[model samples]
Target chain A: LFAATTVMADPLPSWSDTEVKSGIVAFVETVTDPASDDYVTPSDRIAVFDNDGTLWGEQPVYFQFIFAIDRLKTLAEADPSVLSSDVLTAAAAGDMETVLAGGHDALFEILNATHSGMTVDAFQQEVAQWLEDTKHPDTGLPYDEMTYQPMVELLRYLRDEGFKTYIVSGGGIHFMRVFAQEAYGIPPEQVLGTYTNTEYAMVDGEPVISKVPGIAFVDDKEGKPINIERTIGRRPIFAGGNSDGDFAMLEWTTAGKGPRFGLLVHHTDGDREYAYDRESPIGRLVDGLDKGPGLGWTIVDMKQDWQRIYTGQN
Target chain B: LFAATTVMADPLPSWSDTEVKSGIVAFVETVTDPASDDYVTPSDRIAVFDNDGTLWGEQPVYFQFIFAIDRLKTLAEADPSVLSSDVLTAAAAGDMETVLAGGHDALFEILNATHSGMTVDAFQQEVAQWLEDTKHPDTGLPYDEMTYQPMVELLRYLRDEGFKTYIVSGGGIHFMRVFAQEAYGIPPEQVLGTYTNTEYAMVDGEPVISKVPGIAFVDDKEGKPINIERTIGRRPIFAGGNSDGDFAMLEWTTAGKGPRFGLLVHHTDGDREYAYDRESPIGRLVDGLDKGPGLGWTIVDMKQDWQRIYTGQN
Candidate 1:
C-alpha cells in the first residue's frame, strides 16, 4: 500500500503570479532553508511592515486623519473654542487641500489637543469605539476591514516561515495597539510606531498613565529606521512599505550585511481600490519607486500583482 | 520491586528558604497552574524586571554611571576640550558628589558627547568592549559577572514556568541591549530602558543609525510605567524592582484587574554586596519599602533571603 503525503496550497493565495510574489517567495525560501548559505535563525527572522498604505487602504487620506477629523467635529460641537485651530478650521470646512498643506506639525497639534490629557485606557477605548462605529467614507467598510488581502496573507506567510512580523508605522503606537492584534495578528509588543509622551500619575487613588500633548517621536521617513532600531534592537531581514515614508526603512534593511528583502507595494489598482502614487500627497510613493529597482527592491504592483484588493471583497 | 523517585530540588537554588523566595514561588505556581483561580495564559504571563539594582548589584553606583565615568575619562584624556563640560570634568576628576549633583541633564549631555555621533553598531561594540575589559571597583569581577545569582535563577525559573521575562531599566537602552541576553537570557527586544534619539543615515555608501546625544525618554520613576505601557502594551503580571524608581511600575502591575505580583529586591547584604538604601542618594528604597507591606508587595531582603550573591562568587 502506497501512502500519499498531504500537500499545502499557495501561501499567498491573494497574490498573483507576478515578479513581486516570486521575489518574496524566493527570499523567504532561501533564508529559511537549512542548507542555504543565507539561512537565518528563527529568532533573527524579523519582518517589518508599514501599516498605512502598505497593510491597509489609506486612500483620500490616512484613517488616523479621518479619526482626527471626527474628533475635531465632536469637539467643535461640544466646545466652540475647537473651531479656532487652523487645521480644525480647514477640516470643519471640508476642504482637504488646506488641511493637507498644514503638514505634520498641524497634525501633531490636532492630536495633542484631542488625544492628550486623557488616560491611555480612555484613549484606547475611544480609538476602539471609533474603529468599531465608524465606516470608511469611500469603501463603506469598517476602517479595520479595509486592510489589504494580499498583504495580510504575506504577513501570515512570513510568520509561518519563522519570521516575527512587526508593524513599524507612522501611526500612533497607542492608536494601533487598540486593534493591531485583532486585525493583523500582530501583538502590541511587536507594533512600533510614532509615539507621544505619557506620564504616570495617581488619580483618585488609582494608578493611571496620562497622554501628554506634543509628539515624542515620528516613526516615518528616516525616523522609521531609527525607531525600528530603538524598539526592536535588530535589523529586520524583510521590510515592506508603500510610500516615501518607508524609504529609509527599506534602505536600512537592504543595506544590512546579510541576506535581506525590501518590498514596495505600489498602489496601481484604481478600479478595485484607490490608486495614487508618486503624486499623491498622502502615502506618496515617489523616490522609493524611482530608486527601488537599482536597490534590488521588489516593487509590488497592486493592480497586476494582487488578485484581491481586500479580504472578503475578492 | 521498589522504585526510588529522584526528587528535583528547588528551582531557585541561590535563594534561601525565606519569605521572599516562598512568595515568588507561590505567585508563580498559582498563575501557572490551570486549576488555580490566578491562572494566566502563557502569552499573557509577562514579567518585567528593573536592571540596575533589582537584577544586579548597584552599590557603589549604577553600573551605567561607571560606564559613563570610564567613557568620560577616556574622552578627557584624548581630547582636553571634553574637560570643559562640567559633568565630564567632575566625573573625570573622580568627584562623585559634583558629578551626581549635575543630575540626569548632565548625564544626557555627557552621553551625547561620548555616545552620540557614533553608529549604533559602533556603540554596541564599545559597550561590549567595556563590559569585557572593565571590572567592578571593589569586587574585581567583570561587570557582567556581578549580576545577582538569586535573581538570575529567579529569571530562569519564571521562564521555565512559561513567563516572558523583560528588562525595564533606567540605564541606557543601547547599553543594556549589549549584554542582556548573555547575562540574563533576556533578548534585546524584551529589554526596555531609557533611550536617546538616533538618526538613520548613509555614510561611505553604507547605512548607519547614528546615536544622537539628547534624551529621548527616561525610564525612571513615573517614566517606568509609561515606558512599560508604551513598549509592552499589556500590563505585566509580575514586576520586580529595587528602588522608588520601580514604585510606579510595581503600582501599575499590582493595580491590574486580575492577580498580579510585585517584588522589591531590598539590597540588605552589605557584606556580600553594597546595601545602602532609603537614605542613599542612588537607588533610594524608602517610599516603596514603607508602603510595600500594606500593598502586599514582596520585599526580598538580600542579606536574609539570598544564599548566594554572584553566580560564581557563591
Candidate 2:
C-alpha cells in the first residue's frame, strides 16, 4: 500500500517521461521476478552516490568550503592571531580570488589552523551544530534542506527495492561522518571521504581523539573507484554523480561484469540552481557527458526532469 | 547436511577446544538466522584481511621483496651499467641488511629499478604467472599455495556467512590485484594495498598503463585504518591480521559501535612453521597480543589452535 501510494502521488511527477520510465522499468524488471533476465538478488543490489552537487547544491561555493570559511571567521574573531588580517578579510568576504591566490599551500595553512587542535568528537559536534542553523546565502534555506528532492526520492526508492546505498564523497571523513546519517538516512559508517590523521590521547582523565592536519588521502577522480572497491568490497550496481570528479567512479562501476547503471546529474537549471559546466571550476561535467553515451550512462537534466529542486519547499 | 560434511572434511580437525568452539560459533552465529542479533545483513557483512602473513606465509622473507630482489639481479645481469656492484651483490644474496643499509632512499632506488617501466597489465600477468610455479624456499610448495590453512578456513567461513571479503595489505596494490582473486576469492577490485603511481601512455597508438616509481600510499600501521575508511566507507564487521601492521585496523574495527570482531593470528609453531614474534623481522605480533585482551581481541595461537598450517600434505 505504501508503494502504491508513493507511485500514485508521484506518478512520475517530477521526472521527465523518459527518465522516470527508464529508471522505474529497469529497477522493477531487475527485482520483480527472479526468473527474468534482469533479475538481481537483493544482495547484489547496491547503489553508491556522490555527495556535494549530486545530492545537494554546490553553487557559488561548495557547502563544505563555505563551512570552513565561516569557521575561519569565527575563530579569527576569537583570536586575531589565528589568521592574518588579509586571510581573515578574504575568508569573511568569500573572495575566491584572494583566498585561492595563495594556492594549495595557503589553503593548507588555513585548514590546519582551523581544523586541527580540536578533538574529533568536538569537531563533529561543531559541524553538526553549525549545519543545523547555517543557511545558503541565496536560498536562505538550511544547507541540509537544500538537498535535491528527486535524488532523495530516488535514494528512498532504491532502498525500498532492497538496494544498500552508500555516500562516497571527497569531503573530510570525520566531517561528513558527522551529519550524513541524520541528513541522508545513510549512516555515518556508510559515508566515505578524505581524512586527516587522528590520534588518541588522554585529556584530563578521559580519552580524546584529536585531529591532526596534513593530507591523508584524496578521494577525487580516479581515487573514487579505488576507495569504493577498498571500502565497499563490491562494485555497485548503480552509481550516481554530478561531475567529472565522479567520472572514474561511473567508469569503474560500468566496467564490472554484470548489469550496472551509471547516472549523471547535469546542472541545466540556472533559475533553480546555477548552471555552468565544462569550464566551471567546480562540478565540471565535460568529458563525462561526452563519454556517457558510449559508457551507457543515463544523464539526468535537472531542469527538464525535476520540477522541484530542494525538498523543504516541495 | 552440507555444513556437517564440510566440518568433517576440514583439514584442521584437531584444533584446540577453544579454537574450534570460537571458530564454529562465529561462523554458525553469523549464518544461521537472518533475524538473529549476531546475523549481519548480507550488505553490511564485510570482512577485511591482511595478505603478507595472514593469508600466505610471510616468514623467512616477504615474497614481494624477494621478487623485487630477483628482478634487480635479472636487470643487473642484463645491463651491468644500470646497477652498482654493491646493490647487485646485496640483491643476489637476499641480504636486506646490506641493501637497506642505504635506508628509505636506497630502497626506493632498488624498487624503481626493479618495478617501474613495465605496463601494469604486463606486470600483473607476470606476477600471476610467477606465483603459478614459484616455490617457497622452505616448503617447496608454490608460494601462492602456502596460505595458512586455518586462515583459509576462516575466509571461506566468513564468505559462506554472506560476508564480502577484502584483502587489505601493505604490498603493492597492482601486485596483489593479480593474485588476490585466484588465491583468496577476493576480486581485484576488493584488494587494497600499498600503491605506486601509474601513468597512462600511448605506445604505438595503443593505450598502456605503466607503473611509475613513487609511493602513492603505504597501507601499514595507522595507514591501514585510514585507507580502510577512505576506500571502504564502513568499518569492517570483521578483520584479521597476523602482525603489528594490522593493529590499527583491529583497533578501528573494534572501536566502532555495534557487533564487531577482531582477530590476530599468533605465530607460535616453529616445527610446523617458523615461529617468532616481537623480535622477528617478519610478521611481528607482540604489541597486539599484549594489548589484545584489553581491546577484546581474539588471539589465534597458531601452534595450539591449528591442526594444519598450509593446505595439502602439511
Candidate 3:
C-alpha cells in the first residue's frame, strides 16, 4: 500500500498530497506512461491552456479589457478629440457603459488606441511592468501571482512529460505572444490568440514590427477551434481550460481519434479564489461543467483538489 | 554532355526541354546537390509559388471569381429570390461592367449562397469537377491543362529536392484548397490564400467543415507575407510568380537569411501564350522584372525559356 502510494505520490513538489494526487499528478501519470493504455507520443502530446481565469485571475473584470477601457477614459480626459467620432460622443454623454456594448467592433476601437504603434519589445516591457505592479482588487495579489498554482503545476507536469504546451486564448495574439514565453515557458510562435493588424517597417534603418488598428483575427468561442486548426494544424492530446469560452476548443481537442484528455478547472474555491459560473460575464464555466462528465472530461474541483491557489505569499 | 543532359532531363515527362533546362533543372540542381554552395537542407527547403498566373492561367480574368459570377447569374436567373437584395439590384441593373466593378463585397454576397452549406469534401469534389470541365474562353483547354508546363515541372522538381512547397495567392483559401492538390500536387494544408469564415458542425453525428463567406483573411500584396508568417511560421527559401502582386512576397522571401532564389516568369511568348507586362491588368510582371537584376532575382522570359506553354496539345 505504501509502495502504491509512493508510486502515485504527488509529483508536484510545492503542492499538497490531495492537490497532487487528485488534480495534476494522477492525470499526468496516466497520460504519460507508455505502459498505460492512455500513453501519447511526444509529437502527438500537445497541451493547450486558456489564459484569463485558468492562467491568471479574471475576477470582477478581465484585466486586459479593463486596461483598454481605462485607456479610453484617460485619452478622452486628456483630449476629447482623440477619441473616434463615435467613441467621443459616447464618452461625452457618459455612455462608457455601452461603448463596448457594440461587441467586437466597439472593443476594437477601444484597444486600437490603447495598444497600437508601439514596437514589439516596448509593448512587451509595458505588459511585464503592468503585471508586476497591478494587483487583483479582490485577491490583493500581483496580477501575475494570482495565476492558479495547481494549473501552473499541471503546465510544468505536462511539459516534463514531453508535451508541447500552447496558450490558446481570446486574448490578443501580439499581446499574449509578448509575455507568454517568459511567463509560461510557451514560445511566441505557440501562442495563438486574437490579433490586430501589424506592419513591418524600417525605422532609422532598423526593422520594427508596428501594431496597427484593424481587425486581423478574433479567437473567441467558436473562433477558438478554427484559429487553433489554422495555426497549429494538429489536434492537441490534452487541453486545460476553466471557462465556457474554451468549450469548443475542448470539444475539438477531445474529439480527436486517439487517446485525449480534457480537464475543466472549476473555480469552486470561493474563499481562496472566487466562484461564479454560468452567470458570471467573465470566465463562465457553465457549459463545460454541465457536459464534462458525459464527455469523459475531468472537472477539477478547485476547493477539494488544490491546497494552494496562488503563487508568492497569498 | 549527353549523359549529363539525360540525367538532368525533366522529371515531369510532360514538360519540354527549354522549360526543364531553364527553370526546373536549375532549381533542383542548385538546391539538392550537397557539394554545391547553393544546397539547402530538407528542413530549410521552402518554396512558394503564386497560384493565379504562375500555377494555373489567370488570363482573360481570374477564373475562380469568374466561376462565382457565372454561378451567381445562373442562380439569379433560376430563382430571383435566391439573390440577396443587393445582388438582385446589381444584376437587374444589367451592366456587365457594373457587375465586374462591384468588387469583393458584392462577390461575397454571391458566394455565401453558392459556396456555403456543403461539407468540405463535397465542396472540394465540386471544384475538382469544375476544373476538369471548365475551359479557358481564349485557350479552349481545360483549366487544369491550361497550367504553365514549366511551372508544373518546377513544382515537381522542387518537391523531389525535399522542398516543402506552398501556394501563396490572392485567391480564396476555400477555392484554392479545393483543386490545388489535384491540379498542382500541393496539398490543402500547404496552400495559403484568402479565407472566409468556417463553422464546425455535427451533421448526422459526424464533424463537418462548412464555409461561410465574409473575409477571414486576405492574402494579397502586403498581406501575402503577413499571412505566410501568421500561418506557415517558416519563411521560404525560394519563391516564383508572374505578377507585380507577388512583388512583396518575393521581396520578403528573399530578405530572409541563407541562399535564396526568386524567379519571375515574364510573359513574352505571344504566339504560344498571351504576352503582356507593366500595363496589363492580368499577371503584370513590371516592378519585379525591372528590379530583378538589382534584387538578384531570376527573370524567365517565357518565349525564350519555355519551349511549351501549356501541357494540352493545341
Candidate 4:
C-alpha cells in the first residue's frame, strides 16, 4: 500500500482531487499507456495552452495590455511625442476606462506604437526590464509571478509524461517568449501567438531583424485553430483555455478523432482570485461555460478546484 | 588505434574525407563538448538547412515548382478550366521553355491555382499522391528519393550530436512537410517555408482549416532570417544552403556572436548529378561561390566532396 501510494502520488499537487483533476490524469494515463488503443506516440502528444488567463492572471486588463501601456508611459518620458493619439494618451496615463472603451482598435494603436519600430531583441529587453521594475497594480507582485501554480504544475506533469507543451496565446509571440521558458517551462519555439511583419537587413556590417509595423496574423477565436494548424502541423491531443477567445481551439481539439481533452479554467473565486464569467471584459467566459460541457470539456471552478491559486499566495 | 577506429567510425559516411567533412566534424565536436568555451547548451544547438539545393537536388527548377506543375496537369484532367492562363497552359503541357521564360510571376500564377482553395490537409495529400505517382524526368527516380544522400547523413549526424535540425526553405511548407519526415527525418513544425493565408470554419460540426490565396510570408533570401527570428526565436548556431537565395540565411547565421558555421553545397558533379551552377537558371550558385568562401563558409564541391549523391544511385 505504501509503495502504491508513493508511485501514484499526485502529479498536479495544487489541483484538488476533483473530476477536473481526475479527468486530466486519466486522459494522460490512457494516452500514454503503450498497449492502450488511445495511446498517442511521443511526437504526436502535443498540448497547447492559452496564456493570459489560463496560465496567469488577466484581471483589470490583460497583463500584455498593461505591459504595452507601461511601455508607452516609459517611452513618453523619453519623448512625449509617442503619445500621438488620444488612445495612446489615455493608455499611457493608465486610464483603463477610456482605453477599454476604445476596444481592440485602441489596443492595436498603442501596441503598434510601443511594440514595433525596434529590433525584436531590443523590444524583448524592454519587456524584461519592465517586468523586473514594475509590479502589478492590484496584487503588488511582479507580473511574472502571476502564473497559476496548478497550471504550471500541469505543464510540468505533462512534460514529465513525454508530452511537448506549448503556449498558444493571444499575447504577442515575442512578449510571452521573454518569460515563457522561465515562467512555464515552455521554450520560445513552443510559444505561438499574434505576430506582426518583420524585416531582416544588414546595417553597419551587422545583421538586424526589426519588428516592423503591420499585422501579420491574429491568433484568437478562429485564428487560434488556423494558427495551430499552420505552425504545429498536427492537432493537439489536449487544449486548455479560460475565455470565449479560446472557444475554437477547444472545439477543434476535442472534435479530433481519438481520446482528447479540453479544459476551461473558470474564474469563480472573488476572494482567492477573481470571480467573473459572463460579465468580465478581460477574460470573458460565456460560450465556454454554456457550450463547453456539452462538448465534453471540463470547466475548472478555480475557487473549488485549486488548493492554491498562485505560488506564495496568502 | 583499434579503440579510436571503432569509437570514431566516420559519422558522416557519405561525405568524402575532405576539408569540408573535417571542418564540420571539428565544429560539432567543439560546440557539443562541455569543456570547450565555444560549447553551446543542448537547447541552443539549432541547425537550419535550406531545402532544395542544400539537402536535395534542385537542378531542374525547385522540386516544389515541379510539384505545382504536375498538380496543375492532374487538376486539368478533372477541370480543363484550370488552364485559364498562358503560364498554366505552358506548365501543364510540360513546356519548361515557356514556363522558364515566365519567371516567378508565372510560377506564382500556376501555384496559386493548384495549391490554394483546398484544405492544407488535402493539399498535403495531393503532394503525397503526386510523389507516389510521378517520377523525375531526368533522374527516373521517385521524387522523394531525390534527397541528397550526403546531406541526409549530415542531418542524422547533427541530430545524434544533440542538434535540433530544421528545414528553412523557399519551397512550399505544405509540399515539403509531406516528404520531409521520411526523406530528411525532420518533422513538420521544424520545417519552415513559404506559406499563404488560410481560414478556419466548422462545416457540419467538423472543424476545417483551408488554404486561401495570398502571400502571407516568403521564407526566401532576407525573409529567411526574419522568419527564423519569428518561428525559431534563437539564432541558429549553424546554417547550410546552396544558392544566392540562401546567402542571407547563412550570412545572418554565421554573423551571430559565437563559434558559428556556414556551409554551401556547390553542384560540381555532372556525372553522378546535374552540375551546372553559375550558368544554370535553377539552383544558381554565383553569389555563394563568389562571396561564401570570403565569409569563412566551406563550399562542398559535389564532385570532390561526396562519395554518394543520391541513395541507391548507379
The candidate scoring highest on lDDT is 4
Candidate 3 iRMSD in angstroms:
3.6
lDDT of 2 by residue, A1-314 (tens): 77766743443445666754467656656654688777778767878999988988887877888888889888878887776657556776678788778776766666776677887768878888888978889999988888888888788777877888888888787777776776778866578777776665446744345788776667788777766655554568788999999988887786666678888999999988888789888898898889986888888888888888897676
RMSD of candidate 4 to the truth, in angstroms, is 1.6
For model 4, the stretches where C-alpha displacement exceeds 4 angstroms are A1-5, A312-314, B1-5
Worst 10 residues of 4 chain A by lDDT: A1-10
Write the number of the candidate with greater DockQ, choosing between 1 and 3. Answer: 1
Clashing pairs in 2: A227-B231, A231-B231, A231-B232
Candidate whose DockQ is highest: 1
Q: For model 4, how does the per-residue alpha-carbon lDDT over B44-132 read when each residue is reduced to its tens digit?
A: 99999999888888856777888887788888999999899888898899998898788878877887898899888898888898889
DockQ for model 2 equals 0.17
Off by over 4 Å in 1: A1-6, B1-9
Alpha carbon lDDT at A79, candidate 3: 82
User: lDDT tens digits, residues A196-253, model 1?
Assistant: 8888888888999889987877888898988888889999989999999999999999
lDDT of model 3, residue B106: 64
RMSD of 1: 2.0
- The local distance difference test score of each candidate is 0.87, 0.76, 0.73, 0.89
- Which window of 10 residues has the lowest lDDT sum in candidate 3 chain B? B14-23
Q: lDDT tens string, model 1, B1-314?
A: 23467665789988889777888888889999999988999989999999998888786888887887788788778888977766778778898888678886777777777778788888889889999899888988998988889999999999999999999999888999998998999988999998888877789998889887787788888888888888889899999999999999999999988889999988887788877788898799998889988998998888999899886475
